[model samples]
Target chain A: MPLRWPRRLGLVGLALPWLLPYAWMVSTSFKTLPELVAAPSAPLPSGLNLDAYAAVFEAMPVGAYLLNTTLMALAIGLLQLALALPAGYALSKLSFRGRGLAFGLVVATLLIPAQVRFVPVFTLLAEVRLTNTMTALVLPFAVSALGTFLIRQALLSVPPQLIEAARLDGAGELTIIYRLLPPLLRPSLVAAFLFSFVYHWNDYFWPLVMTTDDSVRTLPLGVALLREQGTGVRWHIVMAGNVLLSLPALLLFALTQRQLIHAAAGKAAGR
Target chain B: MKLLSPRRPTDPYLLLLPTLLILGCFFFYPLLAAGKLSLYSWDLLTPPRFVGLDNYRALWSEGLLLHSLELTLVFSLGVVTASTILGLALALLLNRPGRLAAFARASIFSAYIVSWVSVALLWLWILDADGGALNAALQRLGLPGWRWLSDPRLALPSLAAVTVWKLAGYAMILYLAGLQDVPAHLLEAAALDGAGRWQRFRHVTWPLLRPTTAFVTSTGAIASFQVFDVVRVMTQGGPMDHTNVLVYAIYEQIFLNLRVGRASALVVVFFLVLLGLTLWQLRLWLRREGAEGQSPPA
Candidate 1:
């Protein structure tokens, strides 16, 4: 803890590898196309030129990509929460036959990553003529095993007496779950929602496989396609598109750093 | 534990039904379908033709499957080892209570939350063979500029480096959380016993962080095994297919090659590998928990 300034400087030095790319990204995004071509590796742009940003917006449907990604991520989050809340509550608070089996089933599904299932899932959707639609993006991710598990862990921390007291007051099971438990489970719920939102917002693999239409293509895919369009690499325009793609997740991280870090740690601990 | 006056046997099941249904349709069903589809050759145009064991045999004979598996293993190993070490180091350095430490933590972890495509494009720009910032910096520093992506030998390592960059922050956050639970009293006790700083950390802190290390390494390995977007965007598993991790290979098989049977077989293999890894982690976790339960109080 001594020599605090030196240590802090050293920490900043170490952080440069992680921070520099983002700095360069934003800097490059603001560079004019001619400047970008002239000095591709320049640390700082000449000035805050908006030519690349303008070009990117003109060339690609940046707004639509953002909106599609946001709507898809929101729908996935809400659906996961709606399904997971009851499932978590049942698994944690309620006792019944086959409860252990049901919980085990949920946990077992965690072993299968979506990457492994995408091929068949893609085919199934294509059979139903659902590919290239928003529903295709949302439906497959509707139930999150991790969300259910996390919520279950959160619910287990709540005292049985509270639910019992509610029961004594003749509160319906639906009311107890939908009303009382959600307030107490706010941290987990928020964590689940944020995780789902950030994950799907940034998801490229599923959207890449599911949708070829620009209408349903998410931001990440849109940015990737932006790079592939021209004869040569347009560094400035690509960087501008990337900056746009990264802003939402970065903003989310900034706003909810503590919750996001804790949720991740809780996941690692397998709670 | 019953919250209702008359315990309805089906109440919990009713609550669980929606979740189970979705998982069944989307998760478990597709898993089984992947297995079944592996036995039959199907293109989008043609009906699936049964070719029992042929897809697996063909992959095994061609050796692409094994090669992809090896490349993935190597990639995952490099990523896991590098990231876990760097992550722990970052966690240790940033664990202090101060604004600088907090800022450092947040800044480092910011990369982990960004989309892989963005990370890929960002790195692609940085690692561009011609006119890349990294090469430009190297030339400015009077050093030789190596092809970071195009070279067969350097490409895999480059992708691994990018992955490590993104994932080390994730591992660091987990290690930071683990460091918080290292039981300060134990460290103090060790200090009281005349242990040096290294000795105390070696004996007390390292031993306590075993669970976190296991979690980080296993999860990192699992994720690295399935890396796709970076490879898809940056390399396309090119420069002699050096960077063709399993997932990308599976993707190529399905979409590009239109060999559904082969892709499904690869998926089955990938799932089995993941299942094995998960089972191994579960065993490690259970053993650790058991040891903790039986250990005498300090």
Candidate 2:
């Protein structure tokens, strides 16, 4: 499929706007303070340096924020998967009363994003005195509607006979689910995990509203505070913090582009 | 087929228990709580006091809510229009199979997954009034550099621009997926019937992409309304409340002002608006998909 030269040029030209900011971020992150101040518009620094990276740590508790964010994201992802798996399997493979209603309720939750319920959830957490805790970050999102829907879609394609055969061989409920569903649902699991991980990791709104102290602040919040507090903030150092925060999601995306794309594209692939 | 759950009628119920319990507590309870809180006035220090519809009345009479609502509309419209058009155009351009096209798609889509914090901060650097990349480019082109965030006129659009940059990739992926289902024979038939490229896309391709467009636009609208981080970080609803969107306004009301009732009222209003839009989208999707046979929801 040969694309016309003009069309190809247009596509590449359009793509540059998206790429340039990221390039500029990486470029500025390595610039020395003098170079950064001297040429803020410079597309490339005169020489690469790690001084800014070092400054990011000195400026704030970036390490602590990063650890908290990583832990929160991981906990949310794993918990969401743990809950979504059985729910998905039940919807797809098991016959139960009110299954349609349960599924409908799950899908209906999609209509209301977490932002809409921010106040109540915050109040509830505060009432429980769990504000500023890691649990504050992860508990609300432990059972994901989107995760359940996707996993169910994935499981619908799996042949029910396999589960039946296993059950007929004296396999218990746990055995059939654990032994048969894991391999079958691996792609959906990966897709859901990555989605949850990326969402929770970069999530700033929830963490911002929930946590007041630097001890509980995530990287994004840390960067936000760095900007707010540091009146004469250094762009290079701040960009270094931004780069460090974005690196994991970027790396994961690079490694799992296929699964991520498929996840968004839905089961149109019919896989 | 063997009856896998012959002896376990309650197996499905057991499996669904955790999900129901969690959602009931966190989701449903909060939903009702949000509603109930909206109907009353309670500063944390004071006992709860019921004020039927007064919060809602104050929200409107105060005018801040109205202003933020208008800003939110402008913001969502800007984002949806830019993302959908750009995304469709890019998807059309990259629909062809090739290494370069795939690379282009991947690179463009990468921005969608990057943290909003990073994107916001990076753009903060790029759009800085004096030393930013954008202004520098303007100077090179013999135009004066403009203050992107500081100017009230430019602040909202500037945030909208960043949003478009980040979200256009997501729209592109959805459109690309939609494009794959446009049967080759239908396209060829249209071509043979004297349909030009634009005509083909307008009549056949675009119509076929109704579901995708619906999904993209609806999701885009909701996501844009919920825009908090970028505004919070970049403008802090500022230069003159030009970038004060709904979610940010709610945050300010509840957290900054300690007006829980007002915040909850805003939440209820926002939820109703989104719910209306979502139901409309679902109706359109179901009708379109039903008419077009059994196409999967994108």
Candidate 3:
């Protein structure tokens, strides 16, 4: 219960192991090739360098890829929000037939990995003449089972009294969901948005399956391409690429970390 | 707060429209189409020919799938163990008292933000045969450079190791969230009663962390099953296909072999296996729920 250093030293010592790999990673990212090869337990770079970073953007369509990734992530996040928020509100609050089954179906779909569905999805896209397009990458993920579930949980926390009062006041279902739900569910929505965006930005499987060229590649897929390029593994560029790859989500995590943790913890408590 | 209307009878359905529409077009349709394509041999260019269960029979008999399934199990088990142990350790560590603990949490989760492809790249460099960081370090230390990726025996384990390295932090973050809700006074009380650290942790802390452990472990296991990027980028399921898993096998089936029907069968089987595992987890959850609900006064 004390705030003194020794009282807290054990706790801080616990974090030391976690800090090691990242320190290595960040240290390596900053270190020169000579330094990296010189010692395994090399110290942090004497100073930061931008050469590897510059090469990362130069070697491939890093700029376009980043732009594509952001836009696709944003598009997917917004679309999921648009689709999931309402459907989740409806499923949570509405008295409707087949509601249980609909909810069950969504839960069931959570078990179907995108990899399992990739082949057929690819074929269907080919049939629709949509292969190798950014749309192919983003469209399938626009409505997420995870988002729907999270939003429903958020909506369930809204009082029935609120809905009942709204209905009694001649408010329509759509209006109640848009107005009543958003105000109450803002935190959940924000959490979902950040989660979805970061997740999509980091997703590799679907984009890998759907797109072939660098022109439409997402960041994760782009990073994969660097490996497949057969230029041999370039450590510095790869480190730069990883830093670039992780920066956005890393930044987002840093920014909204408190809220994200709250949401995750709340959900863990079965909220 | 404004209360919007359900005055329109179709509003609810409209609200569900985008979700259902996207699910149907993107998800459900492809799943159904996957089933349909599995029954018929058609590789995009060919006219569809009905070959019901022929593709399924082939993959089942070939041992390609059985091998992949085995590898997937091994890979999942390895990653699950490594991730959980390291993650739990990290979680416990960061849950301690100190200023750097906050920074430690951030740094650990920073690993999660790295794309799998990049993580694979990072490890690939680490395991490179010639002048690789790890190999170079070992040689410098007068030790043998372990041929991690190239050795068939090491391939799956190496993949698992890389995956664990990538995900341990994320799992730690989840467990950290769980740790935060431990009702700290319990630990304080336990300490006052002559309880040593490990005793308190084992009897009180670990028990409370069950839900979080269950969440992290199950999610980690399931996610590991989809370990295609690492396999693809790092080894491409090579070393004589020693590292191949179900996802990459399915990938090879459809893209490389151009066998749509067979690939679809793999899809069905893969989904069923995952579904079975998930159902098992759900059953355990329900039993836990039932037990909790029926428990005597605390």
Candidate 4:
């Protein structure tokens, strides 16, 4: 097919609506207060300004939010992977008396949205005084039914002869899972990890519900707090804070774009 | 098959223990707890006193439950309908072979990958009543600007617009994958048979895309029903409760109002609604698969 200019312009027109918000976000973040007030609708800033970024840091604990978010997302991802691996392997490859029932139970859990569990879980955490702590943020999501389901689907695609050969060589189940399967399942694992990481990193509801202390707040909550300061709101500073909050996830998306898209598409196709 | 059996009868159980333990503590227990707590009235300061069915009656009589459910349904309907149609349109546009297409795909999908708070805050700035980018642009275009968020009538729609923007890209990716599965030979054959462009899509492409459409719409509905962060950040259930969806309403009942029993009742109702939706989707999916399996190949 020959490339037509009209077609190209039309495609750009379709894409512009999606892309402009991001461009505007970056542009507004770099605008000085005077420039923002003067040219609110201007697509570009006249000069680079670090003052908004500086003001965000001055107003909020950006460093602590960064650290907390990073640690929490990392821990959730690692923990979900750690739990999902063996369970998915067993559910996929191993036969047992209650295998069907166990798989059914896991699938059933998927139907129960996390919102329904928040009140009771919050009470349970508060009873033990775990609220305002990292544990409260991490515990509820330690085991991901969806992750296990995805892993199980991925594991089912592995050649049975490989696992049979390992069994013939007297390798234990754990050895096969940890050693042999990891390499073959790397894409699925990474996909699972990225989903958990991004979901939690961008998660505001859980932290908002679980932690009231500023010290324990994550990046999204921090950005929200910036807005909630109320009256004389600094649009530039708020955008700057949003930029900081969004950078890591956006960078991760850029770096792993292909794998992420493939995984998402693959999952949707029920592959 | 025998080779796949565990070394010990206990091996599978042990492998599943950690997952079961956590799910039991966090998921199963909370579900039952929510049920039991719904019957009792308690603030954080006092001992629980069981007032059986009163909480349910209160939510029903006060009319907040029905009102929030209605709001949530309207909000989700807008989000799901718009996201599905827009997503399919985007997928069809970007499904071609080119570098520009790929870049456009990435750019559109980037919105789905970021946090809701970031998206919400960005829109909050853009939709500000005065000095906002959108209003400023409107004035420049010689059109009057509307108060997007503060106005009761527009708040829910504004939130839905933000949501659709975030989600349409995601739906596009799914539809793109779905489009890939549409057999090329079938399309080529249809084209060679003198089928027009719209005819080819209507007869060949549209039928093949049903599964993807179902997946996109179902998941979109579920996510939209559970929307919280955007509503919390952008409107906080609104200037006059216009955007007060179910989850936000539940949050307010528990955290803000300290009505634990009432919130638990609301939570139970929310879970039931979600459960019904999930089962309906599952049935739709399975029925579609059944119908597809029975259909003759073109």
Candidate 5:
């Protein structure tokens, strides 16, 4: 009820505290070790000194890893959407049997930490000789339990009169899904797509455990490897690589967080 | 009419196809094989030997697994409780009208996109104990500087703090959604009834927030139990394995120690713990819904 400049100023003041670490991360990444560990308060690096990034590249193929992650995340997101959309339409719109059991099973799989089967997956991959392949990175994740459920829930809410009219016009299941359902479900689809994109992009455990070779490393693992040799780790190098690993996802999320969060609320409440 | 039904006839099988096939290949088959493998002792480099529960017996007698289980619980409980409560508070505060609400929300969220690896890498420096940002700030404020990640006594809490920082933003979004759905009229009525802010929150707001609470809490618990990245990057189950959690131990068992059988047992036990908790939640939730349906919305 008053001009509470103190509270307003305090909130802004507090904001800087949280952001200081990120500022440090960005600033230190550009600084030399001497500058980073300086005795007194250090000024932010003024220009491009990519020594940390160069160290990251020399220790491992950080570029190839970024490429691998980009390809893997994009592939998994695209392929999962392609399959999940049609199948979700069928699940939510079509009168199919055993749907409960199927939904239950899909939901159950979400609970199972994919880590629980690490040894078995590793052994199976080894047996199939798919180890160290990007296929190994992308295939298992191409089937997303959450995406199917999300799209299915979205489609379930689309008015059935429209579906009936389309079918009355003799539009096949594929057309109904690809044309009618997806358009109405665009909000939900975008939500699911962003979730899937970020999920796979940030996925570290499977990629770490699965791919031993630098040739197939994703961005997360690439940054992890950048942090250290056996003796000492350079924090600046690791932070630079962290920024690289995260920037794309961060950009996408910043652009779509409102839409994504709104859709999530819509879908969750719709259920 | 048919579409309104949660299940469709053939769609269930089709809905299940991807999850089934993938889980079969990646999860179920491996799990069952790991079960079978657990019964036998194998180095994995050579032909497997059929030891038939010798590994289990040895594990029971050794009680090394009991140690890992304790660590796992500590890791999960500490991280889950801190993150969920604090994250929820941040969400509620930022959910109100403010100039910085949008800015704070986005900043917290930016942390989410960064991988756990990145989060750990960043905090490792921030918590570097000597000249890192954390210590620098503490010392400048004339506070005693503590080694955040390296000190064995404080390492686990240090790990928990970093994780909470990383995840609080995501939880904030979940709660922000929940807060928006709360009917403003109900809060106004409470205010008219002489309810203080805390009382209004406790009575009018908190109960309405249950569904969001359920979703966030369940997801948080599941994620925390399966936590590997933070531990791997920050501690590596280290300062001499003082921080060895279940999944990390499972990693060490299979990869480092080459004990596939023991690792499988750890995983199997963990699955039971997670699945058991989830089923318990579902049953309780259903019962709560059923009981509440008999009452008026007010």
Candidate 6:
């Protein structure tokens, strides 16, 4: 059946609210301060200005924040992948005495909200004087229960004969994991990578608790700090910083749209 | 017994050691530490003095702890209900295979993937009292601008609204995946029986989507209870603490007041509440699935 024009219009109308803030963030970033402050509220900026973007860097150590965030995302994603791959392989493919218990413990970690661990983790880090360091930011999150679960599910779905054949060829477990599994588990690996990246990239709370200085602070915490440190309401600069902080993820998301959708659907199916 | 024996049966245990070590140190160890710390009274400066249940008692007697917990519950309820309903509606509307629908679906889902810090700031600008997009639109419609985050009464709802807007995309994606699993033949059969649209949805679609609903609601509730970034960015649990959720309260207790003991107690409570939620939802989900499995043929 041909969907009517009115229904199409309705869908677009509903979608507008979701789309507008993004447009607003971009637009407001380019707007002059007076235009932003003007009472009537112009929908678009009268002139294209690069002032706010410039000011964002000048006002704070935004470049360092961005770098720190990128590093954290990459490090955390890789670390989680490293930790999860073997564990997932073991949990799914191999027989061990504590297999069920190990799997259960990994799953149980999912139920423990990361927020509840904030104080104690912080305290532990403090005890070792690891607080306010990049290690502190990335270390606690190195192990991912969700990643373990997803990878285990992926490894389980692979035919047992593939690994069996490899084992028959005198392949060690590490060799099998390194060569055989990577290609097989590409999609779940991608999903896990994306999930961990997105989560740590946008993580504000743990970083906020752990880092006291800009040298190690990630983008989200830096942006919030930018707002708090502002003497007056500077929407343009703040919006500019928001766009800067959000752009990498948005771009990554837009580029990998199909894979992301497939990954999400796969996850939902698993659930 | 060689250390690196290739055919060793303990290979799985060896493989899982790194994960277990990290989780043990970070997750399990911290949990035990939190449990112990909850019973003591310490400000970071002083050595923790054991005061069994005093921190927990203080949390109840001081009353702000309860207030924050109540606010968290109310906030989670509002956001979960609104987001799930809106998400389901949008998913239904946009589930068809058309260019327009695809565009709309992508547009709707984009919000959820963006950073919450950015989402909070963008909405902060939109919900600004003057020159804000929302107030501006309201003014054009001849309505007076209202204090959204500034007024205590409106702060929690404003936070809830922002949360719903951000999470709608996540819920929509989940529902869309769930919708795909609903058997088309069953829907066709219901339609052939001359069932109305609402009747088909209520009886056929709704029942089929229960697992998805359970997944969505349970996860939504858990995430909402752990709400922190938006509140930290938007309100800082301010305007007379109307928007102070449990996580934010924990942060405040630990950082602002240096009440690590009380904060640890709060964390324990938060953990238990979350665990309880997961278990409760699991029970409900299992029961529903069980009932469906045992149902007589339609």
For each prediction in turn, the share of the native Cα contacts (below 8 Å between chains A and B) that it retains comes to 0.68, 0.62, 0.50, 0.73, 0.53, 0.64
Cα displacement (Å) at residue B34, model 3: 1.8
Candidate 2, residues A10-30, lDDT tens digits: the string is 767767887888889999999
Question: Candidate 5 chain A — worst ten consecutive residues by lDDT sum?
Answer: A262-271
A1-271 per-residue lDDT for model 6 (tens digits): 9878888798788889888878888888898777766642678888789998899989888878889999989999999998889888888877657778988899888876679787888888898999999899888888888888888877777887777788899888999887889999998899889978988898888898998887898889878777887866688899999999888888888998877777665665563
Candidate 2 C-alpha lDDT tens digits along B148-239: 99999999999999999999999999899999889999999999999999999999999988878888887788788789889988999999
Task: List the DockQ of the predictions in order.
Answer: 0.57, 0.58, 0.43, 0.59, 0.49, 0.55
Q: List TM-scores for all candidates, in order.
A: 0.96, 0.94, 0.89, 0.96, 0.91, 0.95
Which residue pairs come into collision in candidate 1? Answer: none
**Model 1 DockQ, alpha carbons vs. true complex:** 0.57
Which is the leading candidate under DockQ? 4
Clashes of each: 0, 0, 12, 0, 7, 0
| True lDDT of residue B203, candidate 1 | 90
Off by over 4 Å in 2: A1-11, A267-271, B1-6, B288-298
Off by over 4 Å in 3: A1-49, A164-172, B1-8, B181-193, B289-298
Positional deviation of residue B120's Cα in model 1 after best superposition, in angstroms: 0.7
Candidate 5 at residue A91, lDDT? 65
i-RMSD of all predictions: 5.0, 3.0, 6.0, 4.8, 5.5, 6.7
Model 2 chain A — which ten-residue stretch has the worst lDDT? A262-271
By DockQ: ranked, best first: 4, 2, 1, 6, 5, 3
Clashing pairs in 2: none
Candidate 3 Cα lDDT to native: 0.76
TM-score, predicted candidate 1 vs. hidden true structure: 0.96
**Model 4, which residues run further than 4 Å from truth?**
B1-3, B288-298
Better of 3 and 4 by lDDT: 4
> What TM-score would you give candidate 5 relative to the actual structure?
0.91
Residues A12-60, model 3: lDDT tens digits: 5655554544455566677666665565445467788766677777788
